[model samples]
Target: MARLETAYGPLPTDPGEQSRLFYKIYSAYSDRVGVLDAHGSYLAARDIGIINLILFILLPGFAWWATADVYRAAMYACALFSAYVLTAAAAQVYGVRLVENVLAAASADHD
Candidate 1:
């Protein structure tokens, strides 16, 4: 398929094509770094487990210990969890943009 032209450069229009391109980039980097079988699922599972541990148990426990009020602790936990979620989302976006910019530069060089 022909790539879609943009100010940045040519970009894949098909979702599957873009995914494959990204996979190739990641695979090359992983192979060079000797990270065999580096998969998103593993990273995601680890992140989720850590987040859950902190969000569901540690945060509330610590908050309660500090505040000694169940309602206040609950509110504090909720606020902290919301901030964590937003920060994670922003980081994800930044990572995606970094990858996109790298791909664009690589493609531009090839052209």
Candidate 2:
């Protein structure tokens, strides 16, 4: 197993542990973004979960039904979903980097 060094100490490289760490960091960052209050966060998470379910599950089924071509429709739907996921991930990463840079600059100015 690998390890990551954080202010608290070293973290295990286990997938579950890594995922929980990531979620904690993400939740903190989201709070900093100020777009979501408690109720807003809950609603946003629920809406996003439903949208993802529809995109990955219902959309493909609908596509297959509409096209009557299981293989082609399913592949196309999967490709589209994959692209959407990648784009969203890239945007999230970019936003986090932007936030980090801004924070670093502000700290440097204070110093």
Candidate 3:
């Protein structure tokens, strides 16, 4: 698959004959990311309530600076990023399960 960069983000353009399959995967990934971003707002709210938003950013922000030569800030930021990924993954799993269950029930009724 070939990659194409647009206003939204990177997308697979050269799907060859499997464009549909490629798009299905991409759509799922996009949905997961969207869910993560939506849920991350709750986390942001909590951080804001505690006034730890800056602290969170600054702790590593400073540690990153203090360490020098390397990007400690990015590493610390990665901790939050990993959390977002896990959150997204869990939501996606739940979504898939919900869809499967619904489909199974519908099929059982028809049969």
By lDDT, the best candidate is 1
The TM-score, computed over Cα atoms with residue i paired to residue i, of candidate 2 is 0.45
Q: Which lDDT values do the candidates have, in the order given?
A: 0.58, 0.55, 0.49
* Prediction 1 TM-score vs. true: 0.52
Candidate 2, residue 3: lDDT: 21
The TM-scores of all predictions, comma-separated, are 0.52, 0.45, 0.36
How do the residues 1-111 of candidate 3 rate in per-residue lDDT, one tens digit apiece?
112222224543565734564444445543454444544554554444344434555576676678773566777767755655655555565655544443333334343
Clashes of each: 0, 0, 0
Task: Give the least accurate 10-residue stretch of model 2, judged by summed lDDT.
Answer: 1-10
- Indicate whether candidate 2 or candidate 3 has the larger TM-score: 2
Local accuracy of candidate 2 as per-residue lDDT tens digits, 1-111: 122232324665799986676555445445443323333544544555456646776677788888899997879787767756765565555555644543343334343
Query: For model 1, what is the error of residue 36's alpha carbon versus the real structure, in angstroms, after optimal superposition?
Result: 20
Sort every candidate by TM-score, greatest first.
1, 2, 3
Point to the candidate with the largest TM-score.
1
Better of 1 and 3 by lDDT: 1
- Whole-model alpha-carbon lDDT for candidate 3: 0.49
lDDT for model 2, please.
Answer: 0.55
- As for TM-score, the candidate ahead, 1 or 3, is 1
Model 1, span 30-52: residue lDDT tens = 53322232234345544764575
